[model samples]
Target chain A: MNVTDLCGLAPPEPLERILVWLDAAEPDEVATFRLPHVPYPLFDHLTLRPCCWDTTEQADGTALVRIVRQ
Target chain B: MINPEFSLPLAVPLRFFRTAPLWLLLAGVLFLLEPSTVLSSRHAPEALALTHALMLGFAGNIMLGALLQVAAVVAGVRAARAGLAGLMVWLGLQLGVALLVAGLWFMQPLLLQGAALSLSLTLLPLAGWLFVRLCRSPACDPTSTGLAFSVLALVTTVLLGSALVLVLTRGAALPFAALLRQHVLWGSAGWAGMLLTSVAVTVVPMFLVTPPWPAKLVRLLVPGTFLLLLAMLCWPVLMPLLVLPAAALVLPLWRLLQQSKRCVDPARWLWAWGGLNLLLVFGLSPWQAEDGILDAVVLGGQFLLGGLLPIFTAMLGKIIPFLLWLDYRRQRPLAGPLRHMGQLFPERWLKYLGWLALVAGLCWPWGGVAATAAGGVLLVYALLLLGMLRQACCKAVAALVV
Candidate 1:
């Protein structure tokens, strides 16, 4: 499911919150997670991380999980 | 990054020409009335009157009106009282200045007494109200900070003036000369110098499309200059402290010059001229005896007023045309290419005038009569600038209609 569908499934109160995170893989990168209802235009000029949902072990043997909004 | 909301007030943009003609007339009157006083005295009543005419009558009107207009334009808050507030301030200022000048010229105790009180009281509330309005606006910036300091300086200057009036009237109270010295410091350095510098910080960058001022310089250096002036006012013996702020100014000035893309503009050239005039003032700071002090004060005053102010006036000549064009274009869409500011005036003539004024100002101390003659030439130059401005405004309006 897309992030929007995931938001729809969640409680409305929690869906209204905005969550931000920094990517560990690229320390300089900033990520934001928001409800599907939020306007995309607001972030047009801004830098943001794409939402993902996966957990895997890299060739280096380090396990990684997709970060989600708290 | 181009914020339309950051525009200057409607009145501010036109003020240079509106007041320039009057200042030119006053310049003539000042020179004619007291040519001898130019290099021999620190405080002649006629000269003092002319000084106030330039400060309050000319510069004061333009600065205050422009500030009000700028605050409204930039902040997106219309003047609560609208045109009426502006009208009152202008009329009160003009009438007050006329009475004060007349009183000073005749040395009439009754006239000076009443005029001094009236002018002070009339302007005090207007300045106070403007300050309140600026503080409440969302567009408040460094320029506003300068205006606020200017208001404080005006208050100090006026109060000292009122005290001088009282000393003249009642002959009872603190030593008047000491108070007058403080008054001079507050009026010149605090009000005139600080306000001009503060506005220049923003204006020079915007006009030349220079890089943004370093954040530290804007936040620290500008306010530091004012603080030094304040210290000087409170402690006369600490007059030596003037050098501190004067030195601080060098960094921003250097940065401004380095950043400016349009080095050829005569207005930018005036910045150097004003700097030289200021340096001349500083150069004479070491004179010890009264006669030596008088000589320094006279020559310095000539450079500061006759030399530096005319250069500032020349810059305004350049600024007004572009402002007029912008205002006109905003009201109506243009179909073809727009003219640059240089096209609005006789650029060659302006350069010649600037050169003449600079040469005359530098030579005035050595040759008093010749300096006055140069002042006459400066007066004509000012009048010519006014005429050019008038033509530019007319052309812009016509273009907008077409």
Candidate 2:
């Protein structure tokens, strides 16, 4: 499992890091992303790629997204 | 696993984005030609044309495109053929806005009639489709709910506008003053204001990294504002109540700005400016109905241009560059060095334009030489933004080859 903690980062930085990670990952590799919010736009972006992600809201108002490159 | 339901093409919104600056430039030209129109009574023919140019041509274009994008993202509303719908709406707006502006500018009844027909045909079906989709959407979030109400307001606005056109063109014995007032209210506060608030609820937090607005307050805002508008319409004496929502938003915006951790960008400052001007609009609203035509015109200009212009300009600056970057990433492999958002468009240029727009909006109400000078400022601002957009697109396309 790969973890990319993206808390405190703004906008394109977080999105950019995730894409770079996703692009380099092997098939079926799972990655977890800790984000400032639920990242709905990321969900929209993921539709174009062969990836599945589940977002879980944390008690502290942040979000954890688990993504698997399929 | 979340189902990926939205796959709207970037081109869907890009077309509208590209076309909008031209309309703003056109409004600038009209203002330059007749500076008095900027501060003249709203009933003046040139003033009417100029208003439509900004409202229907510039702002309407941006909002329609944005609505499609936002609806897809927030509500998971998928269009059957987004490209085709986008094209149809784009063409309709081009034709309708041109005719409406020319018709009013020249005081031609026939052209006004045609403009009314075209705009109605284009906007009504689009609004209906969005409303239905929003109703059936699974997402019950505040953004989605607010979008739904805003669409309803848009429908009401368009209908009232069409009726006003008939009165103007066909001499339909309607109370022109009353109908025009209702049309402006529904269009300005009900449609544009509601939509801005809805977008802000999601955008401000996400982009600025500020604490989210209190959910309960966010939830109540759209419906509460809508009810206030309805009350104002039914009982004209309740006009002062308009200040409540404006005040609600201004306080929260001030709070959010203080809490934000993100580095300052043109968008944030523009939003602050927009919020401040919005308060001014509401503050000045009660006086509009009482005696001062000049005050009324200035208030109209402030609401239509000052109140929303900065916010829209800010969104354009933020959104376009990001969209360009996203498009480049989607089309290319990640092997090359990733392009940053700032590289697509210069941050300083946006900063400069933001200040310029502020100056233009401030001087616009003064009329005479000041307004004309402001018009020149707007012309330069539009040209700069248009150039930036073009350069950004060209750069993105160039990256495809490298």
On DockQ, the candidate that comes out on top is 2
TM-score of each: 0.75, 0.93
Where does candidate 1 stray beyond 4 Å?
A1-70, B1-17, B69-78, B286-297, B334-339
Q: Which CAPRI quality tier does the interface of model 1 achieve?
A: incorrect
Contacts from the true interface found in each model, as a fraction, amount to 0.00, 0.39
TM-score of chain B of each: 0.86, 0.96
Q: What are the runs in model 2 whose C-alpha is more than 4 Å off? A: A1-8, A26-28, A34-50, A55-64, B1-5, B289-294
Report the C-alpha lDDT of model 2 over A1-70, residue by residue, as the tens digit: 5667786565677877888788778999998998865665676567767788897767544678998899
Give residue B317's error in model 1 in angstroms: 2.7
DockQ of each: 0.02, 0.44
- Taken over the whole model, the C-alpha lDDT of each candidate is 0.57, 0.81
lDDT for B167 in candidate 2 is 90
User: Candidate 1, residue B286: CA error in Å?
Assistant: 6.1
